[model samples]
Each structure stands twice: as C-alpha cells, then as structure tokens.
Target: MSETDRPRPRRRRPFRKAVGLAVLLAVIGYFLVQRASNSGPAYCTASATGAGTAGAGTVQTYEMTHEQAANAATIAAVGISKGLPDRAVTIALATAMQESALRNLDHGDRDSLGLFQQRPSQGWGTPQQIMDPVYSAGIFYDRLAEIKGYTRLPLTVAAQKVQLSGFPQAYAKHEPDAAVLTAAFGENGIPASLACSGPAPAAGDPEKVRAELARAFGKEAREALGAGRAGAAAGRSKPAGTVSEAEVGLRLKEGGGPAEARRGRAMAHWAVARSKELGIVRVSYDGSSWVAGRDGGAWRGKGGEGGRKGGAGDPHDAAPGEVRIFVARATAH
Candidate 1:
C-alpha cells in the first residue's frame, strides 16, 4: 500500500511544473503585447510602418503635436520669463504643463481656450483669438508679468493671479505634471522628430505665395543667402508677407549663417507679438510657417522662402520673417 501510494504521487509533480511554465509564459506574452500596442505617453514608439516615429532628427507625428504644445508652452514661458525671477519659468511651465498639458485645448472648466485656458467671457479675448496658442500664451504672460513679486509668491498664488480659477489651489496639483511636460518639451528634451497631427497650410497653389515671398525678401537678401528655385510658381512671394524668425531659421538651419539665425529668432518673436495689430495672417522663416492654414491652429509652411530657386536679382525684401524682429529693434532704436 505504501509503495503504490508513493509511486502514484510522482505524477502530480510534472503536471504542476507544466502548469507553472504555462503561467510564466502567459505573463511574458501579456507584457510583450502591451509594449507593442502602445508606447507610454512620455514618448511614442515607432511602428513597423514607421508611424509616429520621433527621435532627435525624426519629428514623429506625436512628437510634432507635442512639440506644438511645447512651443506654446515656451511662448507662454518666455513671456513670463522676461525680467521675472528664476522661478517664473518653472511656475509658468508647471502650470501650463499641467493644465492643457501644453496642448492649447479648446475646452476647459468652462469655455476656456488655449494654453492657459483663458476664458473669452473674462475679457481675455475672443474665442478665436484666445484659441490661438501664441496669442493666448502672450496674454497669459502679460497678466502674469504684471503680478508684482510673483516669483516670491507661492506657486499656487502665482498661478491663481493669472488664472483666477474658482479653486485657486487646484494649480498646485498640476505642478508635477507641468515639470514633466516642461522637461519633455524643453530644448532638445524630446526628439526633433517628435511631431503631432495638426493643420497644414494651403497645399494646392504655392506659386502666388512664393512670388510674394520672393518679392518681399529682396534681391540682395536672396543672393546673400543663396536661395535656389528662381522661378518656381510659389517662389518667394508668400514669405515676404509675414516673415517670422522661424522662416529665417529654416533657411539658416538649412545652412544660413549665424547672423541669419539669430536675427531670425528675434524677428519671429517680434512678429508673433504684433500678430493682433498687423492683421498679418502668416509668418514664415527657418523653413516653417506660423500662419492660418485651411484647417487652422498654428499651421506651418514648406519650401518657398527657405529654398534658393529664385532669380539673380533676388527681388524679395527683408528675407521674409525678419520683419517681426526688425520692427522690435526699430521701436527700441
């Protein structure tokens, strides 16, 4: 009886091992599926078809959207950062990073718009204007900058000053998230290829716009930069209308000089500042366009001014995007 019972007991051991192995394999399979299905929010992973691929040089679709949000965050942060104490950038980034995750959302606690969730009803601006990421961010910074001793103030108080939310303390909860977004979005923090889906400018006919940009950039400016594409339909006309430093940067980044890029950034900021007053619809420089697209919301342009296909005379003025910075300097001068 003892031998029979002992002999029979051995069968359960192998069965138990097999069951354990199956469970282990299943667990590994589950995690593998999860990783393949979705890359975490902090960063998006590339797919087999290379969808949403963002890296230092790549600008994936998600990264681009995130970059747009980051740019909006930077716009707001830089506005508040000027002449303010060190913590101002931190507080501003933190607030925006948390609120809209720097995405300039259309909806919020109640009819809020853009990065800071500024309410049109509160006299911030019109819905269309407030929804403009740069404009909304500018307004937020303007108000925040006006707050005396804001840097010394508690984070909650500083944010409340600009936001005036019903729950003043709520901004504190966002501080951590804001930090993460800030780090992720900061200069080269995320990959250059990190991109998101947004509105693209008019695609059909660029000839008229290019001609305008070429006319605006001036022959001397075009020659100095070695711009190609002398007779393309969308040559240089479009960029001339509103050349932001970004347009300049596109040219420089493509191989424009240091003087060009520096001047370009200064102008882009200046042009963006004057967006409301000028009735200016678009500003392009540095291979990018900040203007109204067929769909809307921070549309960027391509080719045209950033390229060098124009004629020898270089009939464009100010290199298109230099106006914004040039104007600021002019005012100060």
Candidate 2:
C-alpha cells in the first residue's frame, strides 16, 4: 500500500481512560466527604444569662460541637464535686475555651495536651491521664484550689494562675460564653436552661451512663442512685414519689434542703448537657423537664406537681427536690 493510502493502526485512547478514572475518583471523594460530615455528631449551641430568666442580660449564646459541650459538662461536674463555687467553674471553662476551645486535643506547644493544654513535663499528668477529660479537669481544679484567692480574683487572674499562659488576657473574652455555659450546666441554679438540638444519640446504656456519672460526679453520687446494687435495699429507696432503684434512672433526694437541691440540679443539668454523648433522652429537675428530639428540642414544662411524687402524666410538674435522668435504650435511639 502507498504511504498515504495505508490504513493507520487504531490508536488506544489512553487519555480518555485516564479522564474517566479521574472523574470516578472525584465522585467517590465527594460522597465520602458528605457521608463523613453527616455521620459525625451534630453541633449544638446553648446559652444563659442574668438570673437565667427570659429577660436575662443580653442573652449571649455560644456555639460548639457536641464534643465540646460534653467536655464542658464534665468540667463543670468535676468542679462541683470538689465543692468549687460557680466562679471557679467560670474561670476553668474560660481557661479551657482559651486553651483548647473546649476540645480535648492530643497536641499543643511543648508537650501540652488535652483540655487546658497542660504539659506533662510540668506535672500536669502522664499523656494518657491528661488526655482524659475528667482527670484533666480535676487537675485544673486541684491547682486552682491551691491559689490563695481564686474565687475572689478576676477571671483573667484566676485562669492565669492555673494556666500560666503567655496570653493571659485571652481568657477574658471567653468569660461571657463561659458564664452562659456555666449557668446552663447548673453552676448558677438555672436548670433546663441548657438544651441541645440534634438527632438523639445512638441508644445509650443506663449502666454505662451510671459509670460515666460516677466518673464525672464521684462515686457517692452514683451510689446514691443505687448503681451497682444487688439486694432489695440496693436500688429501693423510700423517697416520696421517687423512682425505685429498679428503674433505669437516678432520683436524687430533695429532702436534704437547698444545698442538696442545688446539687441535684447541677447533676441534672450535667446529664442534659451530656445527653448527646450518653444517649440520654430526658432530664427532669425542680419543675422543668428537657427531652431530646422533642418539640424542636428545648426544655419545656412538665406541668404537674414538683417532686418525686409527681405523677408520670406530668413529669415536669414535679416539685423542686430531686432530679431524674432517663437514658434511651439502644433500640430506642
């Protein structure tokens, strides 16, 4: 065949194949990103101010991931266990907000890790210990308590004494947000002020919730709720209208007076704050109730009598004595 007339061998379109492969990979990447974004825990924001009443000051709110909210709850719980006042919690939270943004990070300057960014080399704790939100929070409080006048000191000064950060002033800006969180978490006696908005967490185990409660609030709180009890006396209590030990919840005694009532409210708010993480569905204290995945997800009136004796028909109407926490079953979530 003449050169011009010769049939050219069919060329393989390698470029086309490469383009097809690239497009396929791009589609897969996009879907993976979307799935990851959707499957992770939902973001929640809460706030409280003034008397934590409807007309409270400016009503400042703060936004954070569910993880941050949960950690904030633990911090508040631990501080309360140590008998630290609300001011102490406000300072601790503001410091954490400044140090780690309320996230338990595994990295920071010069071996700093976890919330508050304490350095192991400086006696914060072992890396693993520091990474634990509870331990780290305890350590933070332990040091704060050592400060001669942490409670009366300015927030910045109190936080600076514990954190010793180069940017001491940074903690001040977070004070407002910290205050809101502290109040919502019951540091200032405002139960049900904090509410989370999202799909309820995967069904949570009440046993696991009990263990976590013990870890955060101390063993006495869990024991008081009849956790790990076996005999008739184990879970059974004589409190009027309170849930029995066999029930899948905790009923804190309100008869202990105002101090005890305040403690009950603190625990109740902590449970609500951690509902997303612990699979908690409802928390009732004083005369209010918070239900996850209900009524656009906010605290609402239970509308009955207040106290343990209140009928189930009006869970919110219970009087101000004990707090009740309900965890959703695995299948329920």
Candidate 3:
C-alpha cells in the first residue's frame, strides 16, 4: 500500500492509559471492600463437642456477636470469682443463652429482663437491678447454689430450678454453645483461643478499661491493672519517641503458676471479647498477641513484637502473666 494511503496506527497510548486507570480504580475498590469487611461486626466462635456444643470432639463452631460473648464471659467470670466450679459457669452460660441469648436486655416476656429474664414482681429484683449483668449473674448463681446437688442435676433441671423458665428444655440446646464459650472464657480455655473480628476503635479510654476490669474480675484485676499502668509509666515498650500514657500493663502475676496462667488466659480472652466496647487496640499475654483489626484480631506469635518503638507499647512485651492492653487515645485537638 502507498505510504499516503496507509492507515495511521490506532493510538494505543490513550487506550492503554484508560485501561491502566480502570485497573487502578478496581484495585482501590477491592482494598476498600476488604477494609470494610475487616471492620464489620465482631464475631466469636468455639468448637462444641457434638458440633456447636461445648466440650470437645467436633469441628462445628457456635457463633455469637461481641456483645453476647461479653455478657456470657461476665456470667462465667462472676461464677468463678464466687468460687463456683466450671460446671456452674457452664450452667449459668447456658441459662443466660436460653433466657436472653446472653444479652442484657431492658425488657423481656411479662416484665422479664436482663440475662436470666428475672422479673421484678417475682422478687428477682427491681428492673434496674435485673438489667445489671453482674447482679443478675450473682443472683442466678446464688439461686443455683441453693439447689441441692445442682451440679449433679441434669443441665435443664439445674437451670430450670433457678430460672423457672416456661421453656426449661430450651436450655438444653444452648448447652453446646455454652460449653464452647465456657471452655474459652473459662480458666480451662486456651490462651487467645477466642477471637473477634472487630475493627480498630476510633479512640480508647484507659480508665474505662480499668473500671470494667475491676467490675468484672474484682480486686485482683484492679491490682493487676494498676501494675500494668505503672509499667507503662516506667517506659515499657512503645512506638518510640512517644509516651505510653494510654497503655495498660496488667501483670497477671509476677510469674506463671497454674492458677495464674489460667487466670491470665481468661483475662486475655475477656479483653478480646470486650475489645470493641473498651477501645482496645491490642492485647498481649505470654508469647502471643492480638491486634485489633488484624485478621479479625486473631492471635499471632511475637514476630510482630520486635521493632515496636513505644508510642502505645508493644503488647507482646508482657512479662510472665502480664497482659498489655492498648487503646487508641484521642489526639489532642
């Protein structure tokens, strides 16, 4: 073909540029979706023995939101602090699950309220007191304790005597899920065994964390939390150049003993469950650590522990039974 008659080469540069731009936008959109997914609702699960039942055996998981897990944890913790056995914690958890699905609701069937749906007219307590998970749990445990050989009684029988729910058999179904949670939030549960896919909080309050800890776990928790604050004050791990004023170092104990170690695990899991509400950014106990927004706050080894220069303190730097909790402090305006 003559040179003049030859068709000019189609301009591919603009086409290529447009394609590249579209690809870039798609990539950005993918990341945005991923970020949104990561920050979505908080979820926790445990494998029940017979598939979604607590114990040991099957791979089935019982799932619940951060709120439910927190309530259930509190129920179990109260029972434990009162020197009740694991069985007691399990019964309480299952009963709470059946009555309120582990929620601290302000209302229920026929003036019922709170975790166990205790009614005001029934002499359980006033509506205000019933709404308090701690009080409700304590009262429930008290009633459960009164049942002669309650632990030896059938799960439904035990819970029914205390709850007196119309659907006493309902407690049977939650037993598996309760068992899973009991195994996790209970002292017998593994360290960092439970996880919640909560996004990093906008800000955190160290004081609130301490108050909640004291409220849930009582005096020992308060003392251990104080020790952690002291450590942060004395220049523990952080992101360099910045102070750890917003960090809390809860030394579960000076060293590991069986009770202390188990307690540490329970405390660590509690922080994880309450991470969403407490503005917890990270939780570290023993050689493992969990950072909010990372793999849904899944526990990871100390590989990320190094090179932490101190802005918030390295969570993995916990000594012995220590648990480090970090909050995203509000930046000075």
Candidate 4:
C-alpha cells in the first residue's frame, strides 16, 4: 500500500473524537441555558412610605425571597392576633432569620424544623406541627410572653430567651432585617408597605379568604364583622350586598375601637402578602390600596373608588370600615 493509499487507515477515530467533544460542549451549553432559565430572581424587595397612616414618609424597604416575605407576614399576623406588639414581632423575626433564614423547612439540625428551627424532641411540637409556620410562631410567642419584660430586653437577648440558640449573638446581625420586616408587616408600622414584584398568582378563592381570615383571627374576626354591620345599619341605611362581584368586603366592628383598626390592617396586609398564593389581585384599606403587578407592587391612593380608575367607586370607600379584596375573574384566567 502506498503512503496515501490503503484508504489512509480512515480518519474515523479523529472524526468520532471531534464529534464527541462537540456533543459534550453542546450538552454543557444546553445545561447552562436551562439553569439560567430555571433560576428565579435572586431576591424580591418590598417598601412602604408612611409609618402607618395614609400619609407619605421616608420609604423603608426590605429585600428577601417571596417565601421569606410571606413567612414574615404570617409571623407578624400571628403576633398581632395575640395582641403582641411590634417588639414581640421583631424578636420573633430576628430569631427566625438566625435559625432558618425565615424558611419553613421540612428538615433541620436533628429534628428541628420550620421557620424557627424548633426541635420536636425539645418539645416545640411534633415534626408536623413544628413545620406549620403559624403554629410554630404561636408557640414561640407563647414562650416569649413569659419572658418577663421581653420587649425591654436587647434584640439578641430577647430572641435568645425564646430560641435558646447556642450562638445567641448571631441573632443581632439579623436585627436590621427583622426590624424592617416588622415595620412593613406590623399593624402600626405602615399601611400598604409590603409590596411584592413579579407576576401575580392565580385568582384567589373567596371561600379560602374567608377560611383563612377565620383561622388567623378566630372569633374576633367574625364578631367584628357582625358588629360592624350592626353599627352601619344603626348609622344609616344602605342597600345590602352593594359590593361588586369582583370584590369581597370585610367590615371591622365600627365601635370595636383601635384594636379593630389594627386587626383590619393586619388582615389587609396578610391578604396582600399572600396575594400571589391566594390569587388576590387588589387589597384596600384605610384609603390606601395595593394591587398585584401594579406600581411595582407598592400601595397607592385609591383612585376614585377602586384601586383602578372608573370602578364602582371603591367598595372600601363606600364602607370605610371594611377591608376590600378584589380577585381576578375565573374567566379572566
């Protein structure tokens, strides 16, 4: 066979090696694109202008995942329902930030679980109960209330009293984030302060809203709504069921006092925080409004009546005592 004859022993091995390398590179590129596409935004930020009422002030902001933000809101709601002040909320938030970074984990160090990293063996709850954020938060507060002036203690000290973390000092570093979350989620912190970014969740179920309200507030919510209706009837006559189909109205007891207003705001914010999960589109109370996927998810003054312009004149405005929630129509899906 001549040097160039005998079919050159074929270039098959080199061609196959090149093909394999190209395939490997293509696979790597595909995975890289997939990772980029699947990864969500690194963080979500929420901000509020005024401290509480319907006025403008320096904007206070906090950044976290939607899950973290939602969990923070739940923790705050649980505290407020118990009449625990913002201080208590701050302490709880700080502890959670240190323990589980505000995530409701199914597993943790040993048997610890949920937001507070509570231990089942340590008597926090069963593994299942500790994994429920609301139940865990309630028990955390129950212990905190026994701390004898927990509100007066330093942030780390108070959180340590509840968490009993070996590294108690670690909580202090989270105090700033915890305070920001408390201010955004607490009743007295601000109205419409917590705003989320990204596409809104599916339309919320009205029945679910009612159930969650009752679950979070218990008898207080039902009693307040009834008292509010009675007061409204006594004050002046209005047509029944005047609210639009898209709206769900919850009236706070007219004479239920400041606590009622506080509860109202707490529920309003709760609905807003869980808006994506619950499919709530708009939440309005005390003349301020928050609409999902609007104004960067921040609260704005109710234009005309509804959060949107030219609606049935703001169901909330007509019944100032109520917290009005607007959900997307099923057909709109």
Candidate 5:
C-alpha cells in the first residue's frame, strides 16, 4: 500500500516559478517604460491659494509662492498668442508656475525643461527645444492643439494631453492663472504687469546663469532621466558678462545642463505674481518693458536697476506684496 500510494512524489517544477518571475519583471519593466515615456509626475501643492480668481465654471488657482504671477502671465500670453486657447495657456502657466514658477527651468521631472517642464526623453522635444520658452511653449501648444477638443477639455485634460504628466489631474489648479493672463493679454482685455524681481541683470559671469538652468532642470536633484536627449548632458555656459536676450532665449532653447533658465523664469514669474503689490506696470527681460505705442519693446538696462517700484528686495527672499488679484478689473468677459 505504501509503495503504491507513494507512487512517484510529484516533482516541483521550478521553471514555472522562474516563468512567473520573468512575467512579473516584464510587467514592472512595461510600467517603468510607460512612466518614463510619459515624463513623470508633477510636483504640486494639494491646497489652493486665493492668488487667482475663479472664472468660466472653474474655481482653482495655480498655487505659487508670492512670486509666480508675472511669469505665469508672460507664459500664458506667449501660449495664447502662439494660438493656444485660454485653457491651454492656463494649464501651461499652472504647470510652469507650480513646477518652476513659469521659469524656463532647465530642470524638472527627470530632465524636463522650459516653462512647461517637458522632458526631452519623453518626446516633448530635445533638451534645447524644451528650454526655449517659445520653442518649449510652442511644443507644448503643438501637443495641446492635437487634442481632440482641447479648448473645451478641462485644464488637467488639456495639460495631460500635452505633458503626459504622471499626475494627470495636477493641471486643474492653474486655471485661474491662465484666465488672468487671458483677460490681461486677450484681444482687448486689461493688461496685468509682468516683470523680473531677482538679482538685477548685471555684468556678472554668464556661466552662472547656465548652471542655474541645469539645476532647475533637475540636474541639481540629480534625477535619473534615462537616455536623455543627446546634448542634454552639457551644462549651460554663461559668457563673461550679463546674458543677452538672445543668449537667454538660446539657453532656453538649448535646455539640459544646469537649470539656469528655471531660475530666470522663476524670477520673472515671481515678479508677475507680485506685480499688483509691487505696482509693476510692466516687466521686461534682456529685452524691453511694455510700451503702448512702440512696435519694438524696451529692455530694462543697467539704468533700470531700481525698476521694481514698491521696494522689492532680493527676489529670492519670497517677500509678500501689496497687490492681490483684482478679478473684476482683470477679467475678459
């Protein structure tokens, strides 16, 4: 009975375990690739700040430290003028202001760049393309425009279409910022000021700016951006003087390296974010401030050092300002 009942103990098939493990690994790899291809998740605050006013059935505002409004407005204007609808502009502004405060940060979700924090590896564009505000914004709009119904798409949906962000819903909060920019820069809407409040443009070493761009792109964070765009490894090199507008634009286009662009964009947005309190009627970069009757705008030069009227101290200090969003005055319709 023992001999018959003990008929060959069933042999354990270790290969089955091996096959199971292999399948598990393959699934994990698939998801990893998917996340990597999607440009990763957005770093955002869960709560809302009253900085921006609600409109068009939306009740959210891009959460920014006191300094992101100007940058958000500028980014929104550029996006809208580039043919992106108000919704797209709002998503882009919120993403930038929240991720890098509308700065063309050379950093982000693993080698993401520019105002929208697009990653070159994720097919947003090259690091250079992602860094250039126009190019970057254009790329974002290109993606956004492709959405089936982007204009009517919710802020998060439109942004997710363009960004492929892991946190797909994060873009909802920036609607207010986009709306504000729309009202200010729309066809005949009131103009809200935009400016920079960081270290005044000086004849300092330009290389430093380059480095900052890299850092903002998440280089400082040393994020693991697998197979980044070819030229993305190189850090931005500042020339021996104050960076020119062309240079700034170029750096933004180049992307990758240190995130100097992010820092610059941050300062610019911070100024815009605080414009009302600072009484900043207009803001300009390596280029010009706004002029009502001039085709060519004006760049604030060394002579414009004290350009910030309300005694804005070091921009990095995160000082509070007097102005708040006057929604009624700044609305478009």
Candidate 6:
C-alpha cells in the first residue's frame, strides 16, 4: 500500500488515558459520597470506658447513623423486655449488620427480609411483619433462645444458627461494633452513652413515639407511658393515643432500686436514639439530659449545662428513675 494510503496506527493511548481518568474520578466521587452519607446528616455514638473492657483511662467509641442507632436500641429493648440478656442483643445486632447493615430492609436473598434477613419461606414471618424491626428482632430472639446455652456459644456460631448465611464468618467482623452498641443500650451500659443529633424536622409524631415505645419495651412501657400519664391527667384524661405533641413522659415504675434506675436510663437512651424520628427535642433521665441541635447531641449533667433554658420543663424536671421526652411541636417552622 502507498505510505499515505496505509492505515494509520490507531491512537489507543489517548483513549485509554481518557477512560482511566474518568474511572478514577468516578471512584473518588463514590467514596466521597459514601463518607458524607455515613458522617453527615445525623450521627450517634456509644462510648465505653476502657478501664476494664479495653484499658484504664481509655475510651472506646463506636459511631453509627441515627437510623442504625435507633434499630439497635429497639433490638436491645425487645431483648430486655423478653428477659433475654445483653448477649442476645449482641448476637442479634451482629447478625443484622452482616445481613443488612442494621437497616430494616424490605428485600434480601430469596424470601429473606428485614434486619436479620429472616425469610418467610423459612417461617420467619410475612414480609410486612418482618419489615417491622421490633417484630424481626423478637423473632430472632425467640429462635436464639431455643438454642441451648446460646449465650455461651461463639457469637458467629450463634448468629449462623439464626441467619444461616452463606458467609458465616461475615458476622464476626461486626461483633465489635455490635457489642459496643449493645453496651450503650443495655441496663448496665455507661450512663448517657447513647445520643443522636440530626436536623430538626418540621414536625414529629407523639403517638408514633408512644406506640414505638410500647411495642419495643412491651407492657411495662405501656403502664409507664400510658397509665402514668392518665393518672397525672386526673379527671381530664384523654385517649391513650392523644399524647401531647410537645411532651411525653415515661414514668418508669416508681422504684425498683438500681436495676430500675438503669432501665430508666436505657429507655432514655432509646428516646435519644430515636430523637430525629420521634421529633424528640430533649430527653432527661435521672439527672443528665440530651438535647438535639445542642452540644453535638451529647448528654449533659444537671445545672443546665446541656443548654436548656431554666423554665417550666427544664431537664432537671425529671425525678429519680424517671425519663422525660420533649418532642417537636406541630407548629415548628
């Protein structure tokens, strides 16, 4: 062929470089978005003193989104209501992280669904029921309880029995974070260990908050949140569902000693975990308080240090072993 007519070598290098640059930028953008989604919007943390668990004077903390924290608190509360102990909460949480990253998903492998990916074909529950985090967590605990000495079993082994995941070892990797979250939600968890901060939504649902509390914590919650409110209302009691938008009080049984105290605190943490959803602006338990949009949502001790104005419903308003939840008003702009 004539030199001029000969086919010129294809210019591949420039094409390859352009493609490489696009791929690199795409990867970088993906990671930046993931980081923002994880750390932005709202966040919650569970911190434990390492004096015995890790090391003296060292603090170990696990941070997760407000959604993860709320789901975790529900798991812990349901387990506690069932008298299932903290180990059960840890196992349930690790399994959820492995299966759905602690999100109550509507779809999963085969008929699997919800937090633990329980399948309806395996008799876990209907999709609608399993989609309820409380229901899914309860079902998981029921199955876990049937296993002999499940509390003593290795975390992965116990979770595998419930999940039967293809990758049994995947559950192990989440155990550390799960355990930290469990410690924050359990009765013996560090005081004020669980707190959440998210954008102040325009409004919140007090009835939904009451309903969720009752469902997660069982009849005890009903009595504390319902009967207590009724008694306080005197002759002007309204229907149970008519909780005020601006406030919800959880008067845990007047007294049961230290365990009762911790239970109240755990409930308080639950309120904080769900602050963004329930429109909980402030939560006070024992003496410490947590206020969303303030102090990075950290819990504060008495004396208004948490940024609450001295007024009718201050954080210190809560009596011993009592928890007060102040919600967002419907009129909030």
* Best lDDT among the predictions, by candidate number: 6
List the candidates' TM-scores in order. 0.42, 0.74, 0.78, 0.74, 0.41, 0.78
What are the C-alpha RMSDs, in order, of all predicted structures?
A: 13.3, 10.5, 8.8, 9.7, 19.9, 8.0
Clashes of each: 67, 12, 16, 6, 39, 0
| Candidate number that wins on TM-score, 3 or 5 | 3
lDDT (CA) per prediction: 0.44, 0.71, 0.73, 0.71, 0.42, 0.75
Task: Rank candidates by lDDT, best first.
Answer: 6, 3, 2, 4, 1, 5
Descending-TM-score candidate ranking: 6, 3, 4, 2, 1, 5
Q: Which residue window of length 10 is worst by lDDT in model 4?
A: 229-238
Candidate 1 segments exceeding 4 Å error: 1-86, 167-170, 173-333
Instruction: Output the better candidate (3/4) by lDDT.
Output: 3
| Model 5, residue 72: C-alpha shift (Å) | 3.3
Error of 1 at 5 (Å): 3.3
Residue-by-residue lDDT tens digits, candidate 6, 112-167: 88888888889988889999999999989999999999988899899888777789
Worst 10 residues of 3 by lDDT: 47-56
> Residue 206 deviation, candidate 5, in Å?
19
lDDT of 1: 0.44
lDDT of each residue in 256-323, candidate 4, tens digit only: 77677778877777777777677777777777877665555666776632246564454445257777
